[model samples]
Target: MLGIGVVASILGIAAGLLIDWFPVAASEEAKPIDTLWDVLIIASVPVFVGVSVVVLFSVVKFRMRPGEEELDGPPIHGNTKLEVVWTAIPAILLVGLCTYAFIVLTDVEKAQANTMEVRVVGEQFAWTFFYPGEDGKEISATELHLPIDRPVKFTLQAKDVLHDFWIPAFRMKKDAVPGINVTYRVTPNRLGEYPIVCAELCGLGHATMRATAVVQTEADFASWLEEAAKPPAPPAGGGGGDNGKGLFTSNGCGGCHTLADAGTNATVGPNLDEVLAGKDEAFIKTSIEDPSAEIANGYSDTMPKDYGQRLGADGVDALAKYLSEVTKEG
Candidate 1:
């Protein structure tokens, strides 16, 4: 039985090691974290096989038989050496694993020189990223963009409820708690687009809370940052087309509503294309500012009610006019 168990344990460990279980590693911090996971799997599989083997053997060998239904089996004392061996083995394994984990954590978290700071704000159903711009201003965007091979320190904040800022490829995550700030750091070593997900369930639209992280060449990143930092051009003829579209994209409206004009297909909220057809600008503006005034059929009042504050009067007017124009019936 011991030899059979050993063989099974070896096979299990090999299988665990061979399985590809993670997403692509895109950051410098991901390597050590992935290694830690592999180490855990290697250590855990043998213990799991040993336990299962013992349980199965006991069940087969010592289970009550038909003739022994009313019998109490022989009384047995606990084995002191066995008890100590099991306890001590687990204790030593835990201490070693924990010490290794601490070392990996410390290495990943060591602050690097010239780490760029990015502010991440999580609201119900949306994530907004802010990067420092020229002077004292900040450039805000719905998508996170990082320069490849640069260390980035993210300061996370939540406006309404708790949200977890997770980048799986980077293998780093932290919670954004309301009324406080949390931080984590990563250095992008790959040039690719990765997903940004809210690991916490914030609200009704929690599952829809998603964003993209783009790692770009340094020159491209610099160019994009400079362009994004510039003030938005005023809406043409008081908020009709391009500027309103920009607002829609930047504010993450596409994350909830299905807007054909904006090329968004998310249905967390109403289908703006169908619902807003023939609706006037006043109604649209009210819907944007006070979304809870009238709940749509088969939908909850989950829209954020701060568009009036987030986008000022002129901004709201522009967005209203834009939606009104795009969804207008002939």
Candidate 2:
């Protein structure tokens, strides 16, 4: 039975190790994090299997017989040596795991020269990424873009409530506190796109508070940064289609909504083609200016409250009119 238990445990460990438990490891930190996770699984499997086997074997081998209702089982004294051995073993395992974890954390967060800084701001249901620009200015972007194989430091903050910045593929996460700035460093090793998830329960839109990070070659990243750093084009006459579209992108609306015309496919909010179907300009304006006044059937009241102030009356009306035209079904 002991031999069978050992074999089963080995098989279980092997199976667990073969499972792709996490997303693709796209950053340097992911190596140590994944290794630590595998080590934990290997160490835990034997203990779990041993305990389960012993309990089941004992229950079957020494359970009360059909006619032994009034009989009492023999009492056994506790073994001090066994107790000490179990306690010592667990203590040693815990200390080893903790030490390894700390080492990985330190290595990943170690500062490096020539690291670029990116400011990450978390609001109710959107993310705004700010990259350093020429002349000490900052370039704001709705999406995050980084150069592959380069160390990048992120300074995270929350505008309203607590939020967590997590990129599962990178195996790193940090909290974004309202009144505090938390920072972390990571080096993207692979060129790919990864989801940026809010691992904390921030508010009504907690589930939909999502974003993306794109890691590209150094040259492509530099080009993107240069383009993003350019000042916004002057508003067109009367704030209509083109002006409204620019406002929509500049204000970070594409981070949440699915608008085909705007090339935004985010699922955090209702699909504009469906939600704005047949709605008039006035109704669309109300929805944008005062989103909380009428919450969508499945969405939360997670829209930012300062849009009216940020975009002003003209911008809001233009956006409303633009959506009213673009989202109308034929």
On TM-score, the leading prediction is: 1
Give Cα-based local distance difference scores for all models. Answer: 0.86, 0.82
Model 2 earns a TM-score of 0.81
Cα deviation of 17 in candidate 2 (Å)? Answer: 2.3
Per-residue lDDT of model 2, residues 101-124, tens digit only? 899889889999889999898876
Candidate with the greatest lDDT versus the true structure? 1
For candidate 2, give the lDDT of residue 75.
Answer: 100
TM-score of 1: 0.90
Query: How many clashing pairs per prediction, in order?
Result: 0, 0
- Residue-by-residue lDDT tens digits, candidate 1, 153-244: 99999877899999999999999999998999999999999999999988766787888999999999999888777765334212112378
Off by over 4 Å in 2: 75-77, 201-208, 233-258, 263-271, 274-280, 292-318, 328-330
- Name the regions of candidate 1 deviating beyond 4 angstroms: 232-243, 250-252, 305-315
lDDT score, candidate 2, position 91: 99
